[model samples]
Target: MKREDLLFLPISINVTNKKILLIGGGKVATHKGTIMARFVQNVTVVSPEFTDEIRKLPFTFIQKEYEKGDLEGYFLVYAVTGNHDLNAQIKADAEELGILTSVCDAPLLCDFVSPAIHKQEHVTISVGTNARDAYQAVAIRNQITNLFENGTLHI
Candidate 1:
């Protein structure tokens, strides 16, 4: 249940063609939603307002506030809202619905935490500190990137 537990964990789950629900429309939400679009079957974003970046993405957009009922039957949920109370509440609701939830910037309340990622040609590396020291994780990932690039570490 601690953030440190997520460190050095192996993650191979492919999210392609999964239903991902993103709750928020600001920069943070937009970033999360856009990333999910790479593989998720569909990304649904529910928020009152959106930035140009969010609007331009190829995903379902629902312009609305966070309602308790909105957290029903999604494969995954990301609560990135500016409203702390709503995020917490939605996280709880998602849990009750047996849906996996990740709360951006609030790892303690998340079932899954996003890790700092490093990408190379035909290679992707993810380093997570379980929400502990993200900066340190990123640094470690950079070193791994160097090794991988030089063929010292093979995926």
Candidate 2:
């Protein structure tokens, strides 16, 4: 089956206290960590190099190359290292362990796609395009946020 044909069932998962492994510390990884930190407290980032922004985050940061067993004990994994080979390997490892995985820029290898999220108090809205178009998802999410702010779309 084609990657686009793969269906994603949208659902909310409770990540509080659940282990999360982030395999990268660059711009994309930083963004992912920032978003995840909002919902979960147990996030660990592994990478050889990290941006200053990521260093300031509260999550535990491991300044080393990702190892094979890094996915152990993690409930979810985000492979955003920008290295196709590394991301693929990470995806394979995580899937083998029966863990949910999201490989940045590689939807076919991912078990889940992180959506563009808009949060307003207790209400959170997410927009996604099955990893086909991130810009479009962000634009749609922004439009929805505007509508909510203007009281046009009441929850």
Candidate 3:
């Protein structure tokens, strides 16, 4: 489905204690994994090769290609492999296993879309673009974050 056909709602899921699996080791995985590692306590990233950046996270790293069985016991998964077919397969497997899934750069295959997020203390804000403009989404989130930082927006 195209971006216009998809509508992404920004919501928060309490994943502090849940298991999150990231099935890639490149920049996409590193970027998402870094954000996830901030709030999630249990995360496992799997890939045959890993970038030096992702290796620095406080999470388990498995140096191997993703197998379907590797998805077991995860509450959420991000399919970020460079291969579209592989990412699609991960989404299908996640659907079969009743796990929430997000496929990088492939909105049609994603059950959820990652949004630009800002979290501090007790406040968390997320901004999505309905699968449209990501840069604008971040820009909008930054504007809101500015208000929060300046004490203009408070809970």
- Residue 6, candidate 2: how far off, in angstroms? 1.8
Top TM-score hit:
2
lDDT of 3 by residue, 1-155 (tens): 56779976667887867889999999989999888877885899999989999999999989998889999999999999899999999999889999999999998888898889889887778888887888998999899989988999888
Q: Which ten residues in a row have the lowest lDDT in candidate 2?
A: 1-10
For candidate 3, report its TM-score.
0.92
Clashing pairs in 1: 3-130, 17-41, 18-41
Q: Candidate 2 at 143: error in angstroms?
A: 0.3
Worst-scoring 10-residue span by lDDT in model 3: 1-10
Residues 1-155 of candidate 1: C-alpha lDDT, one tens digit per residue:
66555543557566766678999999998878666655453888899998889888888899998887787657889999888888999998898899889887887888887777777656767887668887898899889888887999886
Candidate 2: which stretches are off by over 4 Å?
none
All candidates' lDDT scores?
0.81, 0.90, 0.89
- Residue pair clashes in candidate 2: none
Worst 10 residues of 1 by lDDT: 1-10
TM-score versus the correct structure, for each prediction: 0.81, 0.94, 0.92
Q: At residue 55, what lDDT does model 2 achieve?
A: 82
